[model samples]
Target: MFPENKKQLKLIYFNMKKIVAYILLVFIIPIASKAQNVSPLYKDSIQLQWVNEKYDSMTLEEKVGQLFIVAAYSNRDASHENDILKLIEQENIGGLIFMQDQAVHQIDLTNKYQTASKIPLLIGMDAEWGLAMRLKDVERFPWNMTLGALKNDELVYEVGKQIGVQANRMGVQFNFSPSVDVNVNPNNPIIGNRSFGSNPDRVAAKGIAYMNGMKAQNVLSSAKHFPGHGNTDQDSHKTLPLVPDNKADLEKYHVAPFKKMIDAGVQSIMVAHLNIPALEPDPKIPSTLSKRIITDYLKGELQFKGIIITDALNMDGVAKMYPPGDVDYRAFVAGNDILLFSQNVKVGKQKIIDAINKGEISEERLEESVKKILMAKYITGLNDLKFLDSKNIFEDLNSDVNKALTTTIFEKSSTIVKNDNKVLPIKKLKQKIAFVPLEQTDYDQFLTHLQKYTNVELVNVKNPSEINLLKDYDAIIVGAFLSNESVYKPYKLSDNSKAIINVLPQDKKTIFSLFTSPYGLKDLDLAKFDAVTVHYQNTKEAQVAAAQTIFGAIGVDATLPVEINANLKEGKGIATKHIKRLGFSAPENVGLGKKNF
Candidate 1:
């Protein structure tokens, strides 16, 4: 029996036949359903037939090429483009994962590369939150942790659908997103804000919701960092992260979301570079390179029939473990359908060809992976390849509709974790209030919004004289905007900021609104504040939402998705009422239909 939340239980009853098929797969039974039905992106038998036809017509070298999905960049020079062109023309690389660049540059390069390729290339990106994750000048959405705060999973689905829409517009086929890692470890360096939450069932529900949204737009979704990368303290990009959980623990926490995702029909699963000792006994061996983990466990035990991809091979997690050609070939032998971001495609391809020729890697195994790749290409409508229309690219990506849905998500996600003394909804607007901005960068947005409600004085907390002046105010509204750059960056308050916060009058009402990760609370003393609001990230929408929440312009409905300390447990939220005000609304909203909710 599969683990199901209340929502999922209702979903099971609604789609009983699909649930039955999933149950049968758990017992290793072959699904008789058509491939089109397996994933919503597939239209009919014609697509499946086309996949077979393509696979049958492919040469041995081309079949080998289908397994390698090399990395590309829109910000690179002609040399890089020429290299990629060579890979497409000679090596016949099947796909590409576009890295950081602008939408226009990426689209132009994608067109150029596709034109050079013999077969239509499968374009993919790591657009977890949105296109802004890997591109410049694109609309950015709230992080998964922010979305995790909302009670409604449907909003999270809209986030995915919008991301899919943007990806489709940019000529991307696969989106390596909806990271289903159950982030239980607060110290987890890589998958902190990227993950939905620490709860397995919640993560599973959110992952499925996101995948289905992408599927609606015919943009394939990839549930990533598989078997789980949630509990590690180390970054796989630098070195291998060892997950200490045993088999039973993994099944309960780590593998739960991946299982649910597979059942919901995810197109691909990106295997993390973590060294999971419970799944594979070999010490220092990345899970991406372990045949026992990828082939025997994932394919055999878990019964995952879709494409299995390795996380970027260029990452030191697996790269440091073996030579240039060895790791890529090992990944192929380990049952990965796509070798993503391989360090050396030339050597890797030759080694894989050698392995196949010598019967080390069987032809049947090679064919199976190649066929899956072709099926994915066909399902994504690559069979009818079309050039990406570059008209209104920037304006379309940053549309009013996208901003409206994003604002709604931020409004719902902004939470009040500790509102002691009922300092919030500062009804006494007549009282003296001072807004102290604490951040590395300028955060005038919060101050700007706060001034709209009341005559709030802006005080630079960096100065010692200003810290002394804060005591004169009836309430000190400390707006701390910590950076959410990468998990690798320190997200705690600076010494100067901490000193200012510590010096603030404990007796006076201090409304501390943190525009950062909730984990940022662990570094500061909670006793210092009269009230605390966790606004997840310092996005423009979050800044406005925090201010609105303070003045009772909007109600606080979100709860903490992750625990900061013992007193502030997960899902801890204090509700507040909204005051009568002229509220703003976008009538031309994109993904905010009542049917979705």
Candidate 2:
């Protein structure tokens, strides 16, 4: 074996090594690759078996029915219930998204509908903040804008988990929440407070955290209103809103959060009724019905592999574009798995069947969405159909733990955006303080909380002439509480209120507490106030927190989540000293555990 010549020896050695390398490649690489792929498949084998079996068992009509998730109102009368029963019996609808009603009523209705259906129906809700978002007699969490103000995103996660827990207890399989839309446009009528904030990164981070928390509770989460509804001023419920950004701008801003959510394995996404010319060329066609937008951009480009749900079909946004049956058919063709809130489920079902018969909608396409729906049902454990326990549901939803968390959210979310002359902490008791109410409704709690610290005079400035009466007080505390019925309502101050604020003596210390949207301050001159605080909502907890912050009972550390104007930007907060009587406690003491739910 010893070579006589060096060149011949080297060539022989190289040939021998090449032969060994080929042997290893032929044998080892395939086995390694097979193992890597097989491992994931093994992990998913049970789910795959269940999905395949259930999908195979489904009749064509049943499979078609699975694609429709109609709207149910717990607050409706007997006629509505009978109508729903008819749809369930005739159309065999697969799911229902519960709308406004009492929690108890919803539970009863859900059980009734489930009994009527041949297959177990998946129940969902728009419980973004909590069950109280749609139903009465249920606990309400802080709005998304309020949650956005917190520095600790962990709290946001806990909020989501808690909401999910309530949703699960109420038998909601899916919670269409964590609206990942980045609210860059402050004037956005529909999505201002519903969205996390103006920053895409922050919105994405918060949305992922929330979705994960909900997922932990076995309640599927949906990142909503894609590609984005945050830039539109028109409410989609009434009309179609246009997202005027090009694809590049959308990817950077509007689509950023959605991309993050999809990458994080979000279970579902709600397609909005928006017109984006860059993505869909057809004029006046909604993104909900645009194949280019849904199939091409979201599914193809983004590679999203989950249930794609359309926003409520009853909304004028898509309803105006097509007739009743056509709307559902177009949305189905556009790649949406669930046709939500169809105006006429019977008609919609027939239309879809007709389309499928005509080869417009392929059997493969129908099976794809139907399989996803069945898979979701399996994932939610609906295959094992268990009725919700109606007893003590309200007590479970509105627990002491939830109340403590609500208080914590308000305390952390209330921001002291402007504090000139250091007028907070109300240290000098010698100065007589007058509490002026500039609210549509009575804000007795705010005044009552202030009165606990010192004897404060109440002045109702309904007219301009009442402004002069405030001059006697050494310091005037203006409490502006706005109605929190809907986000669409005008949050700005009235002209009379503005005039009253202007006539107030600038030299005198005037503390302005705004228990409304931060945008309400945009109309007023910030220089006129000695101190300015934003409560961000008119909730009683917020009122109490603002009052406590004023009297130095609680420290103010929350930063503005969104910009009000040029003078105030996001994250603008002024921390003030607490009085000697003030105290603090850990979140754990209030039952918000560090461990996951």
Clashes of each: 0, 0
- RMSD values for the candidates in order, in angstroms, are 8.4, 8.0
lDDT of 2 by residue, 431-513 (tens): 68888888566688788778878888887777777777877888899888888876556678988888888888876898999
lDDT tens digits, residues 183-253, model 1?
88888888888888888888898899999888888888889898999998999999998899999999999
Clashing pairs in 1: none
* Candidate 1 accuracy as lDDT: 0.84
Q: Pick the candidate with the highest TM-score.
A: 1
How many residue pairs of model 2 clash at the backbone?
0
- How far out, in Å, is residue 507 in model 1? 3.0
Q: By summed lDDT, which 10 consecutive residues of candidate 2 come out lowest?
A: 35-44
**Which whole-number lDDT from 0 to 100 does residue 389 have in model 1?**
79
